[model samples]
Target: MSSTPAPAPAPAPAPVPAPAIADRPPPTFRQKAGFFAMIFGMFMAILDVQIVASSLADIQAGLSASIEEISWVQTSYLIAEVVMIPLSGTLARILSTRVLFSLAALGFTVMSFACSLATSLEAMILARSLQGFFAGAMIPSIFSTAYTMFPRRSMGKVSVVIGLVATMGPTIGPTLGGFITQALGWHWLFNINIIPGLIVAATVWSCIDIDQPEPAYLRGLDVSGLVALATALGTLNYVLEEGPRNDWFEDQTIFRLAVLSAASGCVFFWRAFTYRQPIVDLRAFSDRNFALGCFFSFVVGIGLFGSVYMTPLFLAQVRDYNALDIGIIMMVTGAFQFSVAPLVGTLSGRMDLRLMLAFGFSLFCFALYLNSFLTAESSYWEFFVPQAVRGVSLMFCFVPVNRLALGTLAPDKLKNGAGLYNLMRNLGGALGLAVINTLLVERGAHHLSYLSENLTLSRPEVQAYIDRLAERLGDSLAGGVAGDPELAAMKLLFQLAQREALVMSFNDCLLLIGLTFGAALIVMPLVKKPRD
Candidate 1:
C-alpha cells in the first residue's frame, strides 16, 4: 500500500540567477591596460579626423594643393572611415578583437607615417584613406569591449573614460593642431602618432583576449552585402560632403552619387534582412531603446561636430583671429569637459539615466541658445560662458547617450549595435556640416541683400557713415588713391556688411542646433529604463 502511493512531483528547478555585480570578477590588469590602450588608439583615430582641419591651409601650402583639392584630404578620410565603421562588426567576429584592432593600429600607424612623408596631394589622400579605414576599426572595438568586459556596476566609470575620449579628441583637435603647426610644423601632426600608435598596437596584441575568432562566420561571409554596404555609405558620405559645395543636386557628380547611394543602400538593407548571416546584424533595432538611442546619437552628433565646426570658424572670420587665438578660445570647452567628467560619472550611478539625459540635453540647448546671440564684435569672454556650459552639458549628453543606446543590448549584439550607433553619429556630423555650409551661403546672402537694400546714399545716416570712413581713409591714401577715398569707403562698408551678415548666419545655425536638442528632450521618456 505504501509502494502504491504516488510519488510527489519534484519541486520546480530553482531559477538560475544572473551573476551579481559583486560576484563577477573584476577586470584583470592586462584587460585594464588593453582597454586603456584601445581607448588611446581610438583617441588618435578620431583626433586625426579634425586635426588637419585647422591646419588645412598649412597642409595646402606645403603640398601645393588647390583650395578645392585640399578639402579631399578631410573628405577622403571621412568617406573611407564611414565605409569601415559598420563593416567592423563583421570583421571583428571573424578576426577577433585582438587581431583586428592590432592590425588596424599597425596599419593606421604605417599610413600616418606615409602621410607625414607625402609630398603630393594624391599621395596624402591615399595615405589618409588607408589611415581612416584602419582607424575606423579601433573606435567600435573600444565601445564593444567596454560593454562586454566590465560589470554593470562599473559602467559609470567606463562611460566617463570612453565619453571623455570620444568627445575630447575632436573638441581639442583644432587646439592641438594649431599648437603643433605653430610650434614645429604641420608634418608633426601625423608624426605625433608614431610612438603612441606602436605602443597601442603592441599592447593590444599582447593583452586583449576577450572573444575568440568565430571562423564559422567566415564560411558565410556576406561579400555582396559588404560591397553594397561600402558603396552605399561611401557614396552617401561623398554626396553629403560635396553636395553643399557643389550646389546639391545641381552638380552632375553629386546627383549621380546620390542615386547610386540610394540604390546601394536599398540593396544593403535587403541583404541585411534576407541573408542568413548579414554583414551587420540589423536585428538589434528590434529593441525599442536601441532604436531611440541611435536617433539621439545622431542629433548629439549634430550639436557636437556642428558646434566645433562653427566656433573656430566664427573666431577666424569675424574676429580676424589666427589659428592660435581660435584654439585658445576653444580650449574653454575642452577644459570644462575634462573637469566635469568625474562628477558626471558619479551622478550617473546615483540618478536615473533618463533624467540625466534630460538634464544634459537641456543644458546643451541652453548653451547653444546663448551662442545664437553672438555678434561680430563678440570675443573670448562672450564665448566663455556658452563654451563652459556646452562642455559640461556634453559630458551629460555623451555618458547617458552611450549607456542608453548600448546598455540594453545583449553581449552578443553589442558589437554590431555599437557599429550602427557610431555610424549614425558620424553620418549626423557629415549631414550637419553640409546643411550648415548651405545655410551660411544662402542665409549670408539673404542678410547681405537685406542690409544693402536698407543702406543707400539717399539715407542721411548712410551718407554720414560713408563721410566718416572717407575722412579716415583720406590720410592713408596717396597720389591716385587719394582721389578714390569715397571708393575706398564704399569697399570698407561692403566688408562690414559681409562680416555682419556672416555673423547673423552663424547665429541662425546655432539657433537651429539648440532647437534640435530641445526636440531630443521630448523623446527621453520613451527610452525604457535600462537593467542594472
Candidate 2:
C-alpha cells in the first residue's frame, strides 16, 4: 500500500553539546608547565601596574616630572590596558594562543627594558603605554588558555591559580614594590620584569603546541567595531580614573569623554549583535548562568579592588602609615586568601556553586560591615580579622563565580566570553573606586558641615571645651613657646571635627560597599548548577 509512504521519521534531533567539564584525561606535564608559564607571565603583567603604583613618587622624582605629567605614567598604562582587554579575544583568534602569547610576552619584556632605561617623562610614559598594551594582551590570553588547555575536571584547580594571580598582584604589589625600591631602587620595578618575561616567553613558545593560527580571520576583522570598542573602553576608563580627581562631570574634558564613551559603547553593542562575525560574540551572554555569573564577577571586583583601594588610602591619609606599612597590612588579606584557595577549589567541585557564591558574598558583607567601624585611632589589629575574612571570601567567590560564568559556554565562544567577563570585573572596580572617592569627598564635606553647625561659641558645651583647651595652652602661650591660646584652641577643635568627619565618611563608604554586596545576592537564583 503505497498509501502515503510513512512520513520519514523526523531526523533525530542533533545531539546537544555538553559542557567540557565532564570526565576527561588529566593535563600532561608539558601542558601544565606551559599553562603555568602563561599564568606567571600574566601575574608579572598585572603586578607591574601595582608595583609602579607604590613607586610612583620615586619615578616622579627620578624623572623630575611634574605631578600632572607623572600621573600619566599610570594613566597611560591604564588607558591602554583597558582598551586592549576586550580585543584580546579577537586578537588571539587571529594569531593563535601560542603565537599571540609569545609575541605579547616578548613585547612586554622589551618594553620593560625601555622603561627601565627611560630618563625623561616623555620616554617613560611612552614606554609605559606600550608596556601596558602588551601586558593587557597577556591577561585574557591566560584566562582563555586556562579553559582551553585544561579539562573541565581540572578547571576548579585552575580557578585556584587564576584567583591567586588575580588577587596576589594587587594584594602584595605595594609590599613587593616597597621592598624592591628600598633595596634596589625604583628602576628595579621595571628591570625585574626582564628575566621572568624572557623565561615565560621561552617556555610558552616551546611548550604550547595547540591552537594553530587562523590568520585569515584578521582579514575579515570588524574595523568599525574595534574602533567603537576602543573608544568606549578607553574613554570610559579615563573618565572613571580621572573623574574623582577632576570633580567628575564638572570637568569639561571628563564630560565630553563620557558622552563619547556612551556613544561608542552603544555602537559596539549594536555591531556585536548585528555583525555576522562580530569581534566578540555577545550572544554568549544569552546563557542565563553566564549573564548572572558576570554580574557576580562585577560585584566581586567592587569588593576586591574597592577594599584594596580604600584600606591603603585610609591607612596612608588618616593613619599616617607609610607605603610599606600599608602594604604589610594589606598582605594579610592576600595571605588568608592564598591559604584557603586550595580548599575552596576542592569544595567548589563538590558543592553547589550558588551556595558557595552566597556564602562568599555574605562574608564580604560581614567584613565590610566590620570595617565600617574603623576609627581614627584604629590600628593594624583592628583590620587584621576583617582582612582575613575578606581574603577567605575572595577564594570562595572567585572559584564558583568562574565556574558559573564559563561552565556553559560553547568551546568556540569561550575566549570571547572570558574577555567580556574580565571587562565587567574591571569596569566594576573602576566604577567602585570612582564612586567611593566621590562619596569620601562629598560625605566628608556633608559630615563636616553638620558637625560644625553645632560647634559654635553660643553652645555651652562648645564654649566649655574651648575654655578648657585655652586654659591648658595658657602656660605655654604666656611663655611664648606656643602660638596664641585662642587660636590654638580653635585649631584643636577644628582638627577634632575634621577627624570625626573623615571617620564618618569612611564608615559610610564601608557601609555602602557592604550593602552593595548584599544586594548582589538577589542575582544568585539565576545561576544553574552544571549538569553532570
Candidate 3:
C-alpha cells in the first residue's frame, strides 16, 4: 500500500448485481372480489338455464307458450352460446375484457327482468334470445380473464374455484328453481335473477380492470368461416334439440337441418384450412395434446351434462323423488368433487395425468354402471352413493386431466383451447341429451310393446281382472260393470302399463350411459403423457 498505495488496492471490480425475479403483481383485494363476483354471475346464468328446466310446465302456462315455443327458451340460449363461444376471443380483443364481462352481466340481468315481465310467448322468446346473447359472454370471458389474472403456479387453485362453481350450478339449480317456482311461480325463476345478476354486474364492473384500449387494427372477421361455423352449430343444435321431439330425420325441417348441418360442418373444416384466420383455429388441433384435450373435454362433457340431466329426470319423473331429493343427491356428488378436486390438482405434478384421468373415467363408468341398474324402486341413497363416487372420478379427471391438456400448450393457444374445450363440452352435452332422449323414447316404445304384448288383457288372467273389476264396481257380468268391463279394464290396464313402460324406458336409458362409459375405458390408452 506504501508503493503508490498499490494502485488503490486495484480498486475492487464493481460487484455484479443479483438478477431480479419478475415480481408477480399481487392478486389485489379488488381483483379477488371481482373474480368471485363473476363466479356468482356464472352460477346464476347456469342456474337460469337449468332451473327453468324443472319449471317448463309453469313457464309455458305463464307465458302461454306452446311446447315447441317453450323449447326455444332453452334452445335459443344454447344456440346463442355456441355461436358466441368462438367469437369470445375476438370480442375480447375488440372490447375490454372487464367491460365485456360487466356488460354481459348487465345484459343478462336486464334480460332476466324483461323475461320476468314478458306478457306473451313472443315477448318471452325475444327476451330469452337477448338473454342468451348476454349469457353466452359470461363463461368464455370468465375463462379468458382467469388465465390473464392467475399465474401458472396458481392455476390449480383457480381450477378448484372454477370447478366448484361449475359443479354447484347443477347441484343448486333445480333445487332453487323448484322452491321459487313452487313458492312464487315460474316468473320468479327469471325474476329472481335480477337482483343477484345486478349485484354481480356492479361488483365486476367496480373491480375488474383492463388496460387502456388499443387502436383497432382489427383482424378480418372471417365472415365465411363465421357463417359456416354458425350454420354447422345452429343446424346441429336444432337437430339435437328437436330430434327427440321431431323423431330425427322423419320431420322435413329436421331432415333439412341435418343435411345443412353436415354440409356446413364439412365445409367449415375445409374452409378453415384454407383461411388465414378461421372462426375456430383449426391449427389448435396441430398440438397433439390440445386435440386430445378437445376430445376428452367433449366426451367428458357428455358424461358430465348427460349424467346431470338424466339423474334428476330419473329422480323426479321416474322415481318420483321431489326436487329437494334430487338436489340433495346432486349435492352429495358435488361435495365429493369439491373435496377431491384439490387433491387431484395437488398430485398432478407427481402423477401421470393420463392414468389419473383414466382412473377417473373408470370410476365414472363404474358409477354409471351402478346407476344403470336403477329401477322405479331405487332410493336416493342407492343413487347418491354412485353419484358421490362419480364425483371423486370427476375430480380426478377434471383438474388433473386439464393440467395435462394444457401443460404442453403455449400461452398463445390458451384462448382457443379454453373456448374450444367449453364449446365441446356443451356440444357433447347436447349430443348426449339428444341421444339419450331418443333412446329413452325408442327403448320405452320397444320395451313397452314387448311387455304390454306379453302382459296383455287378451289372457285369461286379464279376463279375471275384468271379472274382479266388475265385482268391485258393484255391477256384475250382467252388464259387466260399465256394460263392458273388458274395455274399461283394458283402458285402465293400458294406462298403468304405459306408466310402467316409461319407467322401464328411463331405467334402460340410464343403463345405456353405463355402456357408453365402458367404451371410454378402451380409449384410455390413447391418452398421451404430459410433456416433460
Candidates in order, TM-scores: namely 0.95, 0.93, 0.87
- How many pairs collide in each candidate, listed in order? 0, 0, 0
Residue range 1-532, candidate 3, lDDT tens digits:
1233333322132111111112234468899899889888877766676777777878888877787778787788788777777766556555656777788889999999998898888888788878877887787666655655665566667766776676567656777788788889888888878888888989988998743322231444467878888889888988998999987888999999999999999988887888655667767677787777777777777888788888888788766777777777777787788788768767665677788777877788888877776666777677777878888877776775565565555544555666676787678889988998998888888987987887755788877886676556543534333666556666666766777777777767666766676676676676677643
Check candidate 1 and list the clashing pairs: none
Error of 1 at 428 (Å): 0.8
For model 1, what is the alpha-carbon lDDT of residue 311? 96
Tens digit per residue, CA lDDT, model 1, 1-532: 2332232221111112124433566789999999999999999999999999999999999999999999999999999999999988888877888999999999999999999999999999999999999999999899888877788789999999999999998898988998999999999999999999999999999999987776656766678889999999999999999998999999999999999999999999999998767899899999998999999999989999999999999998889899888988899999999999999999999999999999999999999999899998899999999999999999999999899999887667777998999999999999999999999999999999999998889999999999998988885676425578988888788888998999999999999999999998888889999876
- Give lDDT tens digits, candidate 2, residues 1-532: 2422232221121112233546445668998898899999989887877787677889999999987678788878878877887888888777778888899999999999999999999999899989989988898887777766677777888988898898788778777887899889999998989999999999999898757666656655678899999999889988998899899899999999999999999999998888756787788889998899889989988887788878887888799898778888988998898899879988877888889989999999999999999999988899999999999988888888988888777767777788888878878888898899899999999999999998999999999998998988885765333767877887788889998899899999999999999999987886798764
Worst 10 residues of 1 by lDDT: 8-17
Report the lDDT of model 2 for residue 294. 88
Name the candidate that leads on TM-score: 1
- Minimum summed lDDT over a 10-residue window in model 3 is located at 13-22
What ranges in model 1 sit over 4 Å off?
A: 1-23, 475-482
lDDT of each: 0.90, 0.84, 0.73
Model 2 poorest 10 in a row by lDDT: 8-17
Point out the higher-scoring one by lDDT: 2 or 3.
2
Q: Write out the backbone clash pairs for model 3.
A: none
